[model samples]
Target chain A: SLSTSAASESDADELQKEQQARSVLRENFLRCLLSAASKNVQFNMYEKVKMEAKFGACDIDVLNFQVSDLHTPIGVQKEALIRSQDVISFTFEI
Target chain B: MEGGWPLLGPLQWVRYVKKQVKVKVGRNEEVRGWLFTVDPVSASMVLVDFMESEGTLVQVVMGHAVEEVQVLKEPDRKIADRLQSMFLPPRTSILDP
Candidate 1:
């Protein structure tokens, strides 16, 4: 059906947007983390960022960004899985 | 609503542009339609448009009769609060100025 095709296309678009937004959020998070680390802020973090895009009633998909870090990269990569909330929701629809 | 002036300290209130704040500048006789653009500047505000009597353009500082800011919408506060929390490091020092 045409509506189905359109829905598929929209879904694809949403995924693309989500990834892009997530990348940006990750970039910013990394920048801050690096900046703070460079300044020696006493936090030794090594974790991953999770970005989820959820559509609202107004067709706006809010990017929910969650960031977590550990003292060692190996901790997140292979040891354990945990996430913290310096998270923020960014609305990307207009 | 917050974080823009040196008074507000070093904080990123605006990710792109400074906030638009509605304000009534001047005393009883010297007031009219005025829209204020607030940023971290020595000047109180940059007047965008004023639909009132013609007078020499002047700065609007709190001491110079600028009224207390009134946040019109909750979104304004939400955005401001978000910006505030985003930049707050876990251990900000008292030596920071």
Candidate 2:
């Protein structure tokens, strides 16, 4: 009984540590996203598709990004929503 | 590896913080930078690269597209401090009248 209780207690501590780490990482990431707002960002998508747009905001699920003046291969779109799955990475200056 | 990066939990993801890593996204896409932070919810990684003439450059590699991530090297104290300050505001100075 003692060993079982000790093991469960250690498990709880590990879970707490993991949660703290997640919160810190998520906070810093949110801060980075906030700084990216209003800045110009270049998105590199699949199939060699690259475009630049004014960084706006991403949805809560991080599934789509709302951008303005999206530069595409054909022409510049006034507004667009970029699916996160289509994008591999995005670059911007801080 | 169980859907690659997205499967890595917070404890494992935190190990890459402050270290230099090379991330492979899709075909022919490889990026190297300091591991600033990884979003646990989205599993995206925020990378920072510093340049002399130019300012710091930030890159966010999506979690779904990450093919592989390899730790290249570890950052020194100075480099870690620089990485942490990139998005933070400048500290206020105390006034002595």
Candidate 3:
């Protein structure tokens, strides 16, 4: 019983360390998104498709990106939501 | 690297921070930059590329799209400082008053 309790204590310690790491990483990522707001961002998508749009905001789930003036091959859309699954990467200048 | 990237928990992903990484994404695109942070929720990586002239480029590679990640270099003291301060607000003087 003593060994089992010690093991559980260590597990709790590990979990706490992981939570700390997650919070730090998440905070920095949120700052990155904040800095990217209103800048022109280039999105690289599947099938070698590339598009540019003014950066807006990303949902908390990170599933969708709300953008403006999305430049497509055909024409520009005044506003749009780009599915995160369709995008490989996106870049913006700071 | 590929399938397990998004599943790599924050504890694992944080190990890559403050280093230089080369990420392979999509078909043939490879992005090289200083590793900043990886979003714990999505596992997306925020990379910073410092240009010669001015300004920095920030690239975010979705976790699902990453094929491979390679560690190129570790950050020096100066680079680590820069990376940490990239998104920080300008410091205000508290002693002025």
lDDT winner, 2 or 3: 3
Cα misplacement distance, residue A6 of candidate 3 (Å): 1.9
Q: Assess every candidate by TM-score.
A: 0.26, 0.93, 0.93
Comparing only chain B with the true structure, the TM-scores of all models are: 0.30, 0.86, 0.88
| Candidate 1 residue-wise lDDT, B49-83, digit = tens | 22257522322222123444333333356444433
lDDT of each: 0.31, 0.89, 0.90
lDDT of 3: 0.90
Docking quality level of the chain pair in candidate 1 = incorrect
Candidates sorted by DockQ, best first:
3, 2, 1
Q: What is the alpha-carbon RMSD of candidate 2 to the true structure?
A: 2.9
- Per-residue accuracy of model 1 over A1-94 as CA lDDT, tens digit each: 9999999999999777655544543333333223322121111112333332222111012122122332342343222222211221111211
- Local accuracy of candidate 2 as per-residue lDDT tens digits, B1-97: 3247989889999899999999988886799999999989889999999878887899999998888899999999899878766676455222212
RMSD of each: 20.7, 2.9, 2.5
lDDT of 2 at B80: 84
Interface RMSD of the predictions, in order shown?
19.1, 0.7, 0.6
